[model samples]
Target: MRGSPPCGTAVGCMLLLLLLDALLLFAGQAAGEGIITNHVVVRLHESAHDDAHQLAVEHGFQSVRKLPFGEGPLPLLPPMSPRREANAVPRKRQRLQKDSRVMSVLEQPGFSRQKRGYRDLNEMEVNISDPLFNKQWYLVNTGQADGTPGLDLNVAEAWGLGYTGRGVTIAIMDDGIDYLHPDLASNYNADASYDFSSNDPYPFPRYTDDWFNSHGTRCAGEVSAAANNNICGVGVAYNSKVAGIRMLDQPFMTDIIEASSISHMPQVIDIYSASWGPTDDGRTVDGPRELTLQAMADGVNKGRGGKGSIYVWASGDGGSYDDCNCDGYASSMWTISINSAINDGRTALYDESCSSTLASTFSNGRKRNPEAGVATTDLYGNCTLRHSGTSAAAPEAAGVFALALEANPDLTWRDMQHLSVLTSKRNQLHDEVHQWRRNGVGLEFNHLFGYGVLDAGGMVKMSHEWKTVPERFHCVAGSIQDNHKIQSGGRLVLTIDTDACQGKDNFVRYLEHVQAVVTVNASRRGDLNINMTSPMGTKSILLSRRPRDDDAKVGFDKWPFMTTHTWGEDPRGTWVMEVGFQGPEAQRGVLKEWTLMLHGTQSAPYIDQVVRDYQSKLAMSKKEELEEELDEAVERSLKSLLSKNN
Candidate 1:
């Protein structure tokens, strides 16, 4: 009788009982599976001004605070006294619901904050036993180490699809890898590894007090560190075989050493990951010498039983001032240059902006948190979280390439680059300096991010059904031999008009990579900036001003400054190159010669189809946007009409 609703008639009693039942149902739902607090959020009607306080007082609430949220809900807090019971918040919510002034009441359920883990259930299927697996944010960003959620290589999804680089082999061309390390020993390919420094079969890193020679080992771990072994951490392709090519440990880097290292066991190795380059001091302009160039050419032509060997190079860590085009290795059209992004989707501080960079991967950012850097195996069976820079970025890309190779082994090196351009994602990747722009074929690219970050899952998926690209051919489009003087504070603009060798044996219809090979001398080389504009109106900054370069005597000589910005664009029109000076003190320069190099296939049917698909998608997106605008306008008009009628 005490709990029964008080009413004058049976119908009134039934209505009261229904209202009580509704309140109890809401209370039960709000209290389900959550910690109950002694507070209730109450939303007052628009006409009930200052009634929230009165209602709280009547409901025995000790204090009320306006919630800075939608509709200005007020949270009523009960006093912490012996009279308070566990159901105080729910009882207050029920009593407030009975007030005509109150529009709605809800018990404020308490929820604890938690770090984001695996976003997808499939991510947990790969049982990684390594202790530092959680710290490998680049592999699977779970919002760990202050990284953004879903900003990663997406390797887990690829692994979930049963591609783990089982048949692929990657070679780490660095100082030397500790092949004897516990995490790498099982995956080490002895037949493919050799020490160009020591000229021995064993490619073990030399002993060092500061672990300076551990660079190759760390890079190797990034590609094929053993998984489920409780070692350092999992690799991007944990089942891939890794070979160490010790070439950077010697006192001097020779053409033979670099050549041998690059071409080492090419038939056995699927991908070659090179992180070292010319000194990133923003002044040095260097690349593969004669023999090394030949070796790279041979590898691409004859490697993988003529399928072509994949070459992955680090773009550089010369920061904003230094352009990666200054480094010939990264700017090389034969190599797939990779840049680095931080965990927060920002361009890394040490990243070099270059148009030739093919893609991007994650590296350690400016954050000094304990788990901020890459987790990989170090020397003497140790693990490290200090691997940073574009040096660390290249190996991650190589590992992703290994995954793709395992998915489809017949893919050629050029095919790998094609897949990279088609499959890499622009997932939250942004550069504060350079904005993303679409090419003629509707592919987006950035100087800092290239074609965007390498997507392991996407690449693997695309590789499984990919067809080998058409035969690649190079055509020297145009050449200018006249000396053009660039006065102090003045710029020199040159234009080249050609048909891109139409009807020739080596004709290029659809562009792949463009190079502006120039021989120039300047009073201050660092002050010079170079840019190239495609026929399709896409501009690529071939070289940025390098402040640290003080080499006034020796300027660029036959330097091949390359760009991938004009990929898939028609090359049968005029091309523009702008050579300008930007520095505190004006400097004089002269462009003695410039040659335009175009490398691409004569015909690519896929590119045309890609453009059509993009156009269709763009049309659909515009249509949807117009429909949304119309719907919004109609709703606004209806709201106005209803208000006038009321």
Candidate 2:
């Protein structure tokens, strides 16, 4: 210190000091709990249920709940000091497994719900009454904004039929809805709204610096904003009521929170409409945790007095770069995944072609201006002229569902799905990518457009006379555990005898959905595409290549891929699955495990009855068609003569 160090030694010493400072900073940051408190969820064996709380306390975790409805509850203790972070949940799980009473432990994973982007609203002068009605081409298209004429939900026809969504309620499960908005106030159902994020009775979205809180309001307007009030455009179901479930205000969502949110007030909430999910960034693949999964099952099995709550989810905005097959919520068989179509009746640019998507609805196109987006209510007592994305598409479907519910309040969730299959009309798109094909049941379906666009009039009319579907029947084909190596430009086929569909307790005739839980190891996940062939020779392209997934180490692991294209197909012969690799990634892949699940109606004789009825209706329709043609010709002649005289 007195003589001063040598130049080299001094430099080394200074560098050492800098290293120490950096280490301290990093360690402090890692150990400092920002906003999230450390907590662990533990499930115990049934034998230890009575002493669950005492065991949790001994293990230094507080018992959040004992004998929870679904899972055992134990909240682990925080770190002893702020200087050190809590152990990883996986590590803690291993440690907890040492205890005979502990069954499982999971560190709560943080989730960021997807957010939709919208342009700022511009002030516009309004002179005409119902100013925005003319702009809502989705409700009644009149060639506005270059949109196709007569390409709409046919809500006007439904309204004329006196089915305007009365006595139906849809919960907008988003940030919040501006109930005070002029367009929505009249139809706001305060009794059904709740803010789970803030634990408040009123589920109002909080205003933040970003001000993206208008999402729920826009969705609400699309579902049940009042009609003829002359504020914004009319909703698909104008007379229906909408409630807001403000659960997305926080940045992080837990399994328990989401489960509670989905099942919250299930007795009164007829339909839960959600537009948010894992990021649309293309690289992320995520879904609900086990507790949330169980909750969805419970919702369908027990909610709404055993009628099942209708769950509508957005198909996602990940586009061709990313597929919705990776989205857990949209891919689930329990949810009705709604995709988006443009006003021109083409598949939206951002629409990811997934077999799980049930139907499509109108939304703004990627090439069009935001003004072409959905015109609906916004926050702050204002109305948005444009709200876009699959987010907007879902609530539109919900509104249509509300009308269906009003038409027949007793229709179960599965009945509503059958209505969609029978009523959704196939739109002729100019693009070949949106090619449509008939499923086994003679219903036209497309991966890009699903079962085509929702027809509000058709759904409501059918709902009025809808017979509830037969009880659900399930059959499982044992796992094909063989391993086959797949190389670039190679294809592998696996076949299974599906005679199990004829089992005594598992009676299945025509299929509703087919699921394949697959395990594959590939050099790159994006290089694989899978196709499933039904016993009747109908092909369902379950997975297209994901171009954005470049992870070289891991591939699909028990990832379930589903298809609705197998509808009405016999599940009795040898079914085949083909996996192909298209890329030359210099590495090969192996298919490890595949399990097949067939879900169908147990009514074996219904198909014959349906065929008989169809034949009878076809004979009557032919006679009516000739008469209608003759009347149209006579009307045209009269119109021509009138034009000549004028």
Give the clashing pairs for model 2: none
| Candidate 1: tens digits of C-alpha lDDT, residues 60-162 | 8777787677655555555444335677766667777888998887776677775553374234666777899988989888788888878999998899999
Residues 351-425 of candidate 2: C-alpha lDDT, one tens digit per residue: 888888888888895555655789988887788777988999999999999999999999888877777777888
**What CA root-mean-square deviation does each model show from the true structure?**
11.2, 33.4
What's the residue-level lDDT of 421 in candidate 2? 77
Off by over 4 Å in 2: 1-129, 366-370, 604-646
Most lDDT-accurate candidate: 1
Give the range of the ten consecutive residues with the poorest summed lDDT in model 1. 114-123
Candidate 1: regions farther than 4 A off: 1-124, 608-646
lDDT of 2: 0.79
